[model samples]
Target: MYQSKYPQNFPENFLWGGATAANQIEGAWNLDGKGLTTAEVVAKAENRKKMSMDAVNEAVLATAIADQTAINYPKRRGIDFYHHYAEDIKLFAEMGFKVFRFSIAWARIFPNGDDQHPNEAGLKFYDQVLDELEKYQIEPLITLSHYEMPLALTKKYNGWADRRTIAAFTNYTKTVFKRYGKRVKYWLTFNEINTGTWGFHATGALDQDSTKNEQLQLRYQALHHQLIASALATKQLHQLCPMSKMGCMLARMQTYPATPNPVDVQAAQVADQKNLFFTDVQARGEYPNFMNRYFAEHGIKITMHPTDQQILAANPVDFVSFSYYMTTVTQANQDGTAVGNMATGGRNPYLQESAWGWQIDPIGLRITLNEMWDRYQKPLFVVENGLGALDKLVNGKIHDIYRINYLRQHIQQMKEAISDGVHLMGYTMWGPIDLISFSTSEMSKRYGFIYVDQDDQGNGSLRRIRKDSFYWYQKVIDSNGENLI
Candidate 1:
C-alpha cells in the first residue's frame, strides 16, 4: 500500500481523476452526421516531423493542411472510444475516480461552424457518456473546445481572425450549456490555449502562405478573438448554470535560465511571460500593458470592437486550469535547433527526460500551482500532467513503473502545494486510458494507466489491459490521495 506523508493536507473534496480530449480520443470523426474537423488533418500523426520550428511553420503545416486526407488521421480511429465508452468508464470507476476532464468536439455539436440545429445523434452520444459518469458518481469537467473546430470554420474564416467565428462559437456554447450544463458543473473554455502561439496547425487558426509578420499578426489576432470568446462563454455559463464553475485552460510550461548571466535570466522571464500571456487576459479580464508593448514591438495590431474590451473586463473566469508536462531552459540567444521552445531553448542539464525529450520536473508542478493561485486568487485545477513513453506488453501485462514513478513524485509535490495554501480543486493526469498522442499523433507514445492494444500504424484489436500502474493509481485514489508509494 502507498501512504502520503501529509495525509491531513489532502483535502477530502480534492478530485482524483484523469482527462481526455474529444479530438484525440473519440474515433467517430465522420460518423453520425459529424462533419470534418481541423484535427483530422492538422494534428494528424503522419504530418508531424522532428524538426526546427522554422521548418514546421513554413513546410509541415502547409503540407499537412494542403494534402491531408482523413484516412491518415489516427485520431479518426482512436482506441474506438466512441464504441467503447461504457467499457472505458467502467475502468475509470474501478479506479475510484471522482472526476473526468474531457472536451466537447465543436464539430460534433455544430457539424459545421454555422448550423441551425445540433444533430440529435451527436448530443445523444454525450448524454449516454454523462449518464455513465453519473452512474459511477464521477463528476465531469468539460472543456468546450479542444483542438477540433469544424474544418469549415478554418477554411472560411481563417479560424478566429474574422469576427464571425465569435458568433459561431457562442452559438455552439449556448447549445451545449442548455443541454448538458446541469450534468457537468465544471467547464474549461479551451484546452491549452497557449499552444495556439506556436502550434497554430493544431488549432487550424493560421493561413499557411502568409509572410512572417502577417503570421504573427494573424496569430495574435486569433488569440485576441478567442480571449473574447472565452469571456463571453464564461458569462453565458454563469447565467445558464449558476452552480457551475468556468475556467480557462492553459499549457503551463516553466523555463529556467540556461546560465546565471543577467541577460539569460531576463530572457527566461520574457519566455515565462509569453506562456502566461493567455491567462493574463482571461483571468484579469483585460490584456496587460506588457502585451500592448509586445504587440507594438512585433508590428501586430489587434483590432477589437469597443464592446470587446468591455466584455473581457466585465467577465473573468471563475477558476484557472492548466497542464504541466515538463520544463525546458531558456537562454538569451535563440537556439535554432530547438523544436518547440516558447522563446528558445538551451536544454536543461539537471533533469532526466522522457523518450520524447520532455524533462521530468515534479517540483515544477508545485511551483506552477503556487504561482497560479497567487496570481489569480481563484481555485486551481491541475487538469493534465503525465509522462508518455514506450510500453512493452510482456505475456499480456505492461510494467509501466516509469509512469508510476513520474506520477508519484508529482502527486507528492501536489500535497506540498495544498499545504502551501493553494486552493487546488483537483488533479487529473492526461488520458487515464491509452489514446493517440496529441504531439506526435502516435499511439505508441502511450500515457495511460489502462493500456489500449494499438500501434503507430493503426494495428491492434482495440483491447484494454490494466498495467501495473493502474492498480497503484487505484490504491492512491481509494485512499483519497493519502497513499503514494
Candidate 2:
C-alpha cells in the first residue's frame, strides 16, 4: 500500500493550467479560409472499439472531402470553440488558471500543407486567443501540431512518410514561430509524437492497403521525419525567439509487471523502454541502443538524411512534456489486455478502472515522474492529466465529485513526486472545458471542470456550466496545491 506524505506543496512559480487540442475543441472547420484536416474526416464512432483507421483511409477521406454534408463528423464541429474561445478563456481565468496549453491547427494556418504563405485569418484567430490569455495574465503553452495536419499533405505526399512533408512541416513551424514567437514563451513541436509508433492517425499518414510489415515501416519513417522536423523547428525557434523554450510532447504509458516473476519484470522493462524512446531521442539527442536493436530485429529500416543526426543532436528539446492518464501492466505470457489512451497492456488485478476501462493508478504517476526526471535530467511538465467521466447536469449544475477525487489524488501524487527531487515544471489538466473525446468521438466521456452542453450526437445549446471540480480546482490553483480539502 502507498503511504500518504505530508507537506504537500507545489513550487512558488509552478504553472497550474489546462490543455485543449484544436481538433477537439475549435469548430468551424471550413471557416476563415481554414482547409480540411485529417481530423475533420474522422466519423463519429460509438466507442473506441468502433473507431479505426478504416474511417480515415484514402477512399473514405476522398468521399468525406467531396461531400462534407453527408456524414456528421464530430471533430469537425468540436465544442465550437472557434466561436466560444473568449467565453471559455474567461471561465479558465475564473478558475485562476496560470497557463493555457492549446494547439494551432496546421490546416487552419496553411490551408494546404504545401502552401507558400500562411492564411492571415488563421493567424488572426490565434492572435485573438493570445490576446485573451494575455488579458487574464495567463501564460500560453502552444503546440504547433496536434494530430490535425492538412488532409492535402496525406494526399499529396502521403503525409510524413515522404521527406517532402518535413519541409512542409518546418515551413509551418517557422511561420508560427516568426509570428507568435515573441508573444508565446513556451511551445511544443508536436502533440504525442510517440503515438506514431502505433497508429498512423497521429502522423496523418494514409496506408490503409499496406501489409502489416509495410505499415510498421511507414510509421517509423514518418516518425523519423517528425523528429527531424521537430529538431529543425527547435533550431529555428532558438534563432527567432531566442528567449522562448521548445518542448517535445509524448503520451507517457507507464508500465508495471503484473507479477514479481523475472519474465514479467523483463516484459515490463521492454514496454517502458518503448514508451521512453521518444523522450530519449528528444531530450538526449540520440536514439537509445535498445530501440536500434528492436528495429533491426523487427526488420524496420528508417531512411534519414545525412544532416538529420546533426540537426537532432544540435537541437534537443528544452523541456519534456507528456500526458499521463493511467498505467498498464505487463505479464510475460498473459492474454488479458488493459485499455488506455494510446496504449494497451496486460491487466493488473490491483488497480480500479474508469468508465472506459482505463486503469487508474495514481502512484504510477509519481513513479513515472521520478523515472523520467532521473533519466532525462530535464524539466518535466505534466501537460495532460485528467479523468474522463460521464458527467450529468442536474438543475443546470454538474456535481462531479468523482472528477474532483480523481484530480485530488493525482495532484497529491504530483506533490509527492515534487518532494522526490523531481524538477517539475508545471501541470496542465487535459482540459478546462468539456470538448469532444479524441478516441471515442463521444462527448459523454468528459474530462473537464467546466461542462459543455452537448451530447454524443452533437445536439445541445452549447452552454458552459461549472462542475463541482471547477470550484475545487480553483482552490487548488489559488492555494498552489496546499488546500486540497
Candidate 3:
C-alpha cells in the first residue's frame, strides 16, 4: 500500500534530464586554457587518504616552474568529455533529454586564482558547447562552482576558510553570469555547498588536526563565505538576467533513526542540523534557532562582517535544489553500544547497500522532498539522484536491471511527494552515461544508463553503448509518472 502517488503524467514543461560536473567528466585537467585545480595535487581517490597541504606546499616551493605544471590525476580526462562532448550531446538527445545539467571548469575560466578577466578561449569553449545543446533543443542548467577550485587559491588563500576567497569566487561567478545569461536559464551558485562539513579532506575547509569545536567553526566560516558569494552572484544575475533561475545545490543524504529511541531521534536531529544549516541560510535567509544553539553549545563563533549580512539579506535564492542518493540510520549509543551514520556506516546490516556501501532507502527520497519543501517553501528541484553499480555487458547488450529497479522505486516515491504538493520542478539523474566515480575516483562504480567502455585502469575503446535501462528511462520520461509504476 503506497501512500504517495506521482502524476498520471508529468507536466508538459516537466524537465526530464541527467547531470555531470566538469572535473568529473571533462578530463582535460590543464589543456586549452585550463589551469591546475586543487584536485591536481590531491591523491587520485576521493574518500581515500588525502595529500597533505603542508606536503603540497613544500613540494611546490622546492620545485621549478615546470614542477608546478598541473598534476595529471587519473580522472583528469575521464571519458575524454572535453573532446567527445559533441557525440555525447547527440547521445543525450537520442535519450530525449529536455534539459541537460553540467558545469564549467573554474580552472578553465580563470587559470590562476585571482585573474580579473576570464580566458577568451575558456569562454569560447562553453559558447560552442552551449550552442550544441541549443541545437538539440536541450535546456542547459549550469553550476557556477563545482567541487573543483583553483589550486593556487587553496595554497595561497587557504580555500574558503579565508574571507578573501569569497570575493574571488564572486568575481569569477559574475564574469561567467554576464557572459552566458542568455542561453543558460538555470544556474546553481555552488555544488554541494555544505560538503565542507564532512568533506573536509577534499574541500580543504576543515583543519584535520583541529578539535571538534574548531571543525565546527571552520565549517561555519566556510558556509558564510559560500552564502555571501551565492547572494552576490544571485544579485548580479537578477540585474543582468531577470528571468534566470538561481538556486543552491547540496548533497543530501536523507537520515532516519534505526530504532524508536530518544537517542536515535537525537541522532537524526543532529544530522539534519549539520546538513541543513547551510541550506537554511540560503533558502530562508536566516539561521534556524536550533542551529544557533548548536553553535553556541559547540563554542564556535563565526565573525561575519556587516556587509556580509547585508549581502545575504539583499540577495536570497529563488529555489532550492539537492542531490539525493541514500538514507542513513542513527542509533543511540546507549551503554556506548554502537552508532553509525551514512558516511561511516560500513556494511550496514539493517539496510541494503550500493556498490560503494551507501545505504538504500527509496522512501527517503519522498521524505527529503517533504523536509525541503516544508523548510524552504521555494520551488525545489532534484538536481541529482541515481544508483551506482557494477553494470555488466553481455551479448552486445548491457542489461542493467539493478539500475532500472532503483530508478523505478525512487521515481515512485518522488511521484508521491509531487502528488502531496511539494512544488517540485524536475528530476535529473546523476550521470546519464557511465563516467568516473566521484567518491572513490574509480571507474568501476558506474552510475549511467548508457554504458561506456572504460575501466579504472583507464583503458577501453572509450565507446558508448546504451544499456537496457536507457529505454526504460526514456519511457519513464515520456509517460511522466504514469509509466513508472
Candidate 4:
C-alpha cells in the first residue's frame, strides 16, 4: 500500500467513478436500428499489426460491411454491455461509485449520419440506462462522440474532412442535449480529440490513399471542423441546458527529455506542444501561435468559415478532461521506439513497463495535473487511466493485485496534485468492467474490477465475475480516498 506525505484528501464532493466508450462496451452493434460504425469495420488485433485508423479506409470498410462474418470483429461483441448494462451498473453501485462516464454511439442515435430524425429505440435504450443510474443516484458524465462515427458519414462526406459533418454532429448533439439535458449535467464533446492529429480514422475517417502531405492537410482540416463543432455544441448546450457543463477531452501524453542535452529538452517541449495544441484551442478558445507556425511551415492550410473563430472564441469549454496512462521520453533527432497510449516516444529507463510495453509512471500523473492546472487554470478531470493486463481466473476468483497496485499509486499522486493547489474536478478510471481493448481488441488484455467471461475469438458464457480489486475499490470509494490498503 502507498501512503501520501500530505494530509489533504480528495475533495468532499470529488466525483470518483469509471468511464467506458459505447463502442468498446456496448455490443448489439446492428440491432435496434443501429447502423454500422467506424469501430465495427476494423478487424481484430490478431489479423492486424496495430490499431491504425489509416487501415480503415473506403475499400476495407466496404469489404467488412459486405461480409461481416468473414472476420471476427471483437468490438461488435463488446462484453455484451448493450444487454448487460443493468447488471454492470448494479455492480458499479455495489462498489460505491459516485459517477459513471459513458458515451452515446452516434450511429445508434442517427443510424445514418445525415438522418432527419433519430431512432427512437436508441434514445429509449439510454433512457433506461439513465433511469437505472437515477435509481442508484449515480451521476452520469456522457461523451457525445467516442470513435464510433457513423460509417455512412465516411462514405458520403468522408467523415469530418468536409464541413457538412459539423451540421450532422451538431444536430446529433442537439438531439441528445434536448433529450437528456434535464437528467445529465456533465458532457464531453469528443474522446481524445488530439488523437485526430495522428489518425484520421479516429476523427475524420478520411481516405487513406492520399500522400503524406495531403493526409496531414486533411487531418488538420477535419480537426478544425471538430473544434468548430465542439464550440457549437458547447454553445447549444448552454442555450438548451444552462446548468450543464461541457468539457473537452484529450489523450494527455506527458513527455520528458531523454538526456540533459538542450536539444533533447527542446525536442521534448515541441512534442508536448503538439499534444497541447488541441486542448489549447478548446480550453482557450483560439488556436495558439505555435500551431500557426506549424501549419505555415508544413504547408497545411486549414479551410475555415468566417464565423468559425468567433464561435470558438465565444464558447470555450467549462472544463478540461483527459486520459493519462503513461509518459514518454524524447530525444533531439531520434525516432521513438517505445510505445504507449496511442503514441510513441523514447523509452524511460527509470520506469517499469506493462505487459503490453506501456511504461508505468505514476508520478507523471502529478506532473500532468500540475502542468494542465498551471496552463489552463480550468477545472481538470482525469477521465481515463488504468492498467490493461492478462488476467487469469482461478476457481471463479481474480486476484488482480497488479491492477490494485497500479491504481493505488496513481490515486495517491492525484491526492498530491490536489494538495498542490490544483482545482481537480474528479477521476473516472478507464474501465471498471472488463470491456474490449481499444488498441488490440483483445478480451485477454483486461482492465476492469469486474471480469466478463469472454475471449479474443468471442467465446464465453458472458458471465460477470467480481475480481479482487472490486472489494478494494469499494472500500476506497466508501472512505472517499481514505482507504487503499
Candidate 5:
C-alpha cells in the first residue's frame, strides 16, 4: 500500500554514485604482478551465441598461461583502469560523486587462488585506487567478488560447487577485511550471490556440465558456498572492522506478471524464488519458506559443513544493496496471452526492451524498492541502476538522448519510492562511465553518462567524452534530486 505522486529530494547524506567491477575496468590484465582468471580466459568469445566447449575446456586446462595471446578474451586488458584510474577518479569527482562502487579482483590478491598471503603488488594496486578515490573525498563501496573469480580455484578445486571454496573465500575475506578495514567502510560480501543458480550458463560462476540437472545442482551448491562465505565475511568484518557497513549485493531485475492469471502469478513467484533466494538468506539469515519448499520438491539439497548453519544464523548483513537494470514479465507457458514486459524469463509482448534485449521498466524500480524493503525491513541501497544503450558520438560530442531518458524516468520512479517511505539510503547508477558488460562482454552495449571512445574490435583512441546525459546527471547530482524530474 505505497503511493506517491510527486518527486521528492533525497537526504543530504544520500550517496550520488556510480558502479564498476574490477575485471571490467582495471585492464592491466596479468600485468603489474596480477594473476590469470576465468574472465581472462572467457573474454575472447564474448557476445557470440556459440562457443566451443573444447575451447573453454582448453582454457580450463591451461595453468596460468603467461602469454596474453593464449588467454581467452583478454578482459584483463580492459580500459586499462590500472593506468587510467587517476583520470577516471578525476572525472567521477567532476560529476560530484559522493561514492564509487567497485570490486576487488580476487585473482589480483591470490594469483593462484590458494595462497595464504596476498600479493603486495595486488594490494598496492587497490591501495592506490582507493587513495585516488579518497583524494576526491568519495567513499568507496567495494564488492569482494563480482562475476570474476580465480581460474586457479576452478581448475584445481572445481570452484564454488566444492565445499572447499567456502573456506578459501572466508580466508580471503579475512585477509581483505584485516588489510583494508581501516580505509574502507562499506563492503558487500558477494556480488549477486543468487545469480549463479540461474546464471551459470551466462556468467559461468559455476563450472559448466552436460546435464541441466547437473548445472542446477552445481549452481545451487555454488550459491550455498557464496551465501556461507557472505555470512562469514559479515561476521568477520563486524568483529574486525567494527565501523564498517557490510551488505550483500543482489542483481535485482524486477518482474511483473503479464496478467492476474494463476500461471503468470506462478511465473512471477518462480522469478522471485530464483532472484531473491540469495537476498533472502543474506537479509533474513535463513532461507524463505517458499524457497525451502521449492528446493525440497525439486530434490535439490545444499550440503553444508558442520558450522555453516550456525555461522550464517549468527551473522547477517547490516543493510541490503542491489543493482537493477530492467524489469521483466513472466508467463506460465509460450502462449501469446501472457504479454507485458520481460527480460530473461518467458517473454511478454507488451513491454519495451533495450538494445541488448533487456526490458525497460522504470516503475519497476519503485516495485523493487518496495518489495525488498517490505520483505527485509532493512535499509536499502540502489547500488546499481542504469540503461545500456548504443551511444554514438557525433561532431566531437556524444548525443545519448536515449540514456538520458532512461535515467530520468528511473530517477523519477526512485523519488516516488523514497516518498512512499522506503528507507532508501542512496542511488548509484551502473557504469557512470563506460565499461565492459557482464552479460554480453562487448563495449557496444554501453551504460554510462560519460562515453569512452572505444569499440568491440579494439579500434578507438580510448579518449573520454561527456555525453548529453553527463550534463543532465551533473544537474541531478548537484540538485540532490530536485532537478531530476
Candidate 6:
C-alpha cells in the first residue's frame, strides 16, 4: 500500500454546492401569470460565427421591447428547470451538494415590475423547488435579482434610471422575504449588480442605442437606485427573516498591469477601484469618494433622495459574495488582444486559455480571495466560478476532461486560499447543469458537470447526462475536497 501526502483539505463545515440563475435555468418564461423579463428580449447569438460577443449584443440590446415572442430570446427557454427541478435537484443530491445557489426571476413574481401583488403561480413554482431541495437537505442561496429585471420597469420607469424603481424593487423584496425567508437563510441582493455600468445588458436595464454621454448618465443614475434598493432589501430581509444573512454579489475580475510601467499600474488600480466601488457601497454601507470624482469627470450627476444615504449606511450586508472566472490586464493603451466575459484583457502569457479565449489562471483565484478578505474582512462566497467551454457528447456521455481539469485546479487554489486565512463561505460552480450561456446567449458554450442535451439552436432531447466531471466533482465533495483528481 502507498501513502499519499497532502495538506488539510476544505474545512469540515465548508459549503459544497452548485449555482444556476432562474433566468438561465428556468424555462416557462411566460408560464402561469409570469410576465416578460428584460432577459427575454435579448436574441440568441449565432454559433456559426466566431465567438464575437459584439454580434450577440447587437441583436440583444438593439431590440428592447417586452414582446419576447417577436425575437429569438434564448433565456426565455432555459433547460426547463421550472418543470425538471425535481430531477435536477435529485442529481445535485447525488453529488452531495450542501447548498444550491439560484436567482429568483423578479418578473415571474411581480409579472410587471410595479405589480400590486405577486403572481401566485410563480410563488408556488418556487415553493415546489424549495420543497424538493429540502427533501435532500440542500440549503438554498437565493439571489433576489440576477439580470432579471421586469421589462415593464425599463419601458415604464426607464429601468433603474428613475428612483421609483427602488420602491417597486423593495415591494418585490418584502414579498419574497415574507414568503421564502423562513426556508432560505442565505440571500444575495443582486447578481453582478455592477454591470449596470460595466456591461449594459448584464443589468438588463440599460439601453444600448443611447449616446455615449447618455449611457454614462443613465448607468450611474440607475446604479444609485440599485444601491438604494439593495440596502433597503437588506433591512427588509432582517425584519422579515431575522435568521437570514444577506450578501452582495459582484462580477469580480482581478486586474493586473499589462507591463511594469507606472502608467499601467495606475490604470489597473483605477480599474480595480471601479470594480470594487459598487460592492463597497453595499458591504461598507457608504459610497466611495472616488465615485464622486468619477461622476464629475464623466459629466454625470446622480440624484438621490435625502434618506438614500441613511438607508445605505444602516443596512450593510452580512457577507460579500462574487464571481471570478478570469483576470484581465489594464494598460495605458486600450489596444490589445482582449479575452474574457464580464471583463476582458490581453492574454496572460503565463497561463492557458479556454476555447472561448478566457485566460485560465487558477492562481488568480487564490490572489483574489486573499485580496477580498483582507480588504473587507468579511466571509466571501464564490457564488459563481466555472469554465465555459465546448463539450462533445460521445457515446451517450460527455467526457469533459477539460472541464474537470479547470475545476480541479480552481479548487486546489481555493484550498490554498482557505489555508491562508481567507474566511471563505462556499463555492457554487456556475451552471452545474449546462444551460443558456449568458456571455454569448448560446447553449454550445457549456459549464456543467451534468450535461443538458440541448444545442445552440435550441434542438435536443432535453435529457440530463452526467459528464465525466460529474463523478470527479462528486468525489471531491464526498471527501470534503480531500479527494482531488
Best by lDDT: 4
Clashing pairs in 2: none
Position 251, candidate 4: lDDT:
94
Off by over 4 Å in 4: 1-7, 47-49
Error of 2 at 367 (Å): 0.4
Worst 10 residues of 1 by lDDT: 47-56
Whole-model lDDT per candidate: 0.83, 0.87, 0.76, 0.89, 0.77, 0.84
Q: What is the alpha-carbon lDDT for the whole of candidate 2?
A: 0.87
What does the lDDT come to for candidate 1? 0.83
Q: What TM-score does candidate 3 reach?
A: 0.90
**Best-to-worst TM-score order:** 4, 2, 6, 1, 5, 3
Q: Per-residue alpha-carbon lDDT of model 4 for 117-235, expressed as tens digits? A: 99999999999999999999999999998989998988889898889999999999999999999999899998999888666547656557878788788888998999999999999
Candidate scoring better on lDDT of 2 and 4: 4
Q: What residue runs in model 6 are displaced by over 4 Å at the alpha carbon?
A: 1-8, 47-71, 204-206
Please provide TM-scores, in order, for all candidate models, with all chains considered together: 0.94, 0.96, 0.90, 0.97, 0.91, 0.94
lDDT tens digits, residues 157-204, model 3? 667888898778878887888889988899998888777665443354
Lowest-lDDT window of 10 residues in candidate 3? 47-56
* lDDT for each residue of candidate 6 in 364-466, tens digit (9 for 90 to 100): 9999999999989999999888988788888888888888888999999999998787888899999899989886678888999999988876788999999
TM-score of 6: 0.94
Number of the predicted model whose TM-score against the real structure is largest: 4
Task: State each model's C-alpha RMSD to the native.
Answer: 3.7, 2.8, 3.8, 2.9, 3.4, 3.9
| Candidate 1: pairs in clash | none
Model 4 superposed RMSD (Cα): 2.9
Ranking by lDDT: 4, 2, 6, 1, 5, 3
